[model samples]
Target: MSENEHSCYRCGDDLPGHARAWDYLLPDPVALLSDEEQDRLIGVRTEQVVTASGVGNFIRVILPVPLDTGHTATFGVWLCVTSRPEWQAVIGAARAGGETWSGYTFSGRLATAVAPWPEVFGARATAVAPGPGLVAQIRRSDERRLARVLTQVWPDSEILAARERGHVPGVMTGDRPRWRDWWRRGRRKTH
Candidate 1:
């Protein structure tokens, strides 16, 4: 096989050139909320940290799913903290970097609904900080299905299906915009 070509481990079939990583801007709870409600509840927001009055404290994390193509699918997700102290502790470890960050582990519920596995939403998860300049990694989950997703290798077809679902417009399962619509809008002539 060529360097660019990859075969699936399960079926020995060619794997498509689908993206190996996906990112979510915000947790499903926040994303589902109206703009006005989000603005009213969210007190402090940043690229990695989200603090809301009634909602909860959230931290960006990474969930790695192994694919049959010997590639890992990385999902940038969010973990909800139950209290301010817990949030602060996690944040402090992340900020400290090096050993402190790498050794830190925390438990929280997943705030993001991953595509093709929206059932994993709100599942209890344990995340460990990888290191500086990297988000925490979801090491384990209480939900059986989600635990399997995290530990077992999945067929490339499954990953591809998730990618396809993520690209569809008006699809609530995957919170992604349809790029084709933007291109069509750009081509339309204005009066």
Candidate 2:
């Protein structure tokens, strides 16, 4: 894999002949939960194991019991723990229904007859991509969270004003029109 490419064990092709390492990437809500929250989300029997490597740090969370999140399935989460504080904050924020950040954790069971979902990880555009359901869930969650943030930051009036004036909204500087901004709507239809 290239330097910039994702070297995540769960998604990387380094392990030859391995169809995929994961069955389902962890849902956004589950990944963002605190350790305690994860225990509750997965169940009382959740097991956490930490491992270190040159690439990065990792934590494997094992759930033996099937829980309810609209379905019945055992979940195993793999977290890329580059930073504990950041990952904790990400999970906490997710649980609180706030920010959308990565490093939450990846979830999946082994790809076998017993597994509920396909074993996959990473974005679809990549050579080694995650399952469609997993991608959709993550994308939808992030989009919803982002939309919420944008809505709170950009009120209806600001958006309407921006649209009418042909300018981006949420700019405090733009609130006070500058002499140099006479060309805010410089684009005119050429006939």
Candidate 3:
């Protein structure tokens, strides 16, 4: 395996496989918005473009669990840069401010499988390359939690519930065990 083909023991996802370590490159216009611009979105600084290379230079944000329940899947947020200049600039700013961002404890929210999702620790930046984008993933073990989180995030969506009857309303009705089976199987497999 190449240097970056580390397996995610938690999720079983083969990230940056040995053969494709350099394949997932990302490049485009990159900029770091000020605090005001960052906060203008749904969440405050939920995402950021880092113009530097260091620990904590990137961040993954996990949404907070709602107050009613405490079991939902967590979403992921990444603060990254798509260009070398962006990374360098952010790193420079950190150094100039006498701020050491390396080794910082960054964590994201988890889907609780229902209401309030749990918290998850983020991986550290062991390597940085100007391609393949800063690929972040939800741990494989967190799949079920993530499903629940997604469901909670959209209550009326019925992602986990049975699909609407395939037959036309008031037109035709018959046993659709196949469809039912599909949903059951899918939900089970996801969980």
Candidate 4:
């Protein structure tokens, strides 16, 4: 393989390119709800904010996980806020730009589960704004596995395998894809 070409660490097959980051369209809870329920409860839905009468408010943020290959995999997840005012405060800081977000932080539960680690769903997390125009970053998590994912560098093979598994449904809706399906496909390709 050429130096610029990327390959799957698990299957030893040439990959199209480096792994790309993915974003969840909605929080797991909202996404799981039926269309009618979502329409009835959600008052305002935007790319950055989601306000629901019974479900609470959510703000989009990025959770960046470091990969061993020096590339970072980012997941566009949502953080659920307890109140409308708290949600507004985070949006304000994010838009104010410059050092306005300095020292600003908020505590909330992760609304979306990362495809690679489904256990992170609804985990308690603390987020901080990196700067203006940038989404909030998950600085800490109460869940041990999620905390490690935030702090540690993961093997490229694991990440690549996750990327492959992400194609199957239920990656974001809390229904985990079966491992056998992914393994069988990989084996088929090799043969």
lDDT of 3 at 43: 29
lDDT of 1 by residue, 1-191 (tens): 34545565546666666547667788766776689988898887887888766666788899999988888898888888765677789888888888888858998777776877776766778998877667889999877967988999988788768867763211223343332242222212223
Best by TM-score: 1
The sequence of per-residue lDDT tens digits that candidate 2 reaches over residues 1-191 is 65343244645644332112232243322333467745543532223322222222233432222222222222343433344564465345344432232233332211111122212221111011133212111211122322232123323333234334531111112323331121122112223
Clash count per candidate: 0, 6, 26, 0
* Candidate 4: tens digits of C-alpha lDDT, residues 41-113: 8998988788766666788888989988888877788877765577788767767767887657887777776
Q: What ranges in model 2 sit over 4 Å off?
A: 1-47, 61-71, 87-119, 123-191
lDDT of candidate model 2 versus the reference: 0.29
lDDT of each: 0.73, 0.29, 0.28, 0.70
Model 3 residue 19 distance off true place after TM-score fit, in angstroms? 32
TM-score of each: 0.75, 0.22, 0.19, 0.72
lDDT per residue (tens digit) for residues 20-125 in model 3: 1111111010122234533442122223332222211343323322222333422333433223454465445434432234322222221112212212212111
Lowest-sum lDDT 10-residue window in model 3? 20-29
Alpha carbon deviation, residue 91, candidate 3 (Å): 8.2
**Which lDDT value does model 2 have at 105?**
38
Q: Of 3 and 4, which scores higher on TM-score?
A: 4
> Which portions of model 4 show Cα errors greater than 4 Å?
1-19, 83-85, 95-98, 167-191
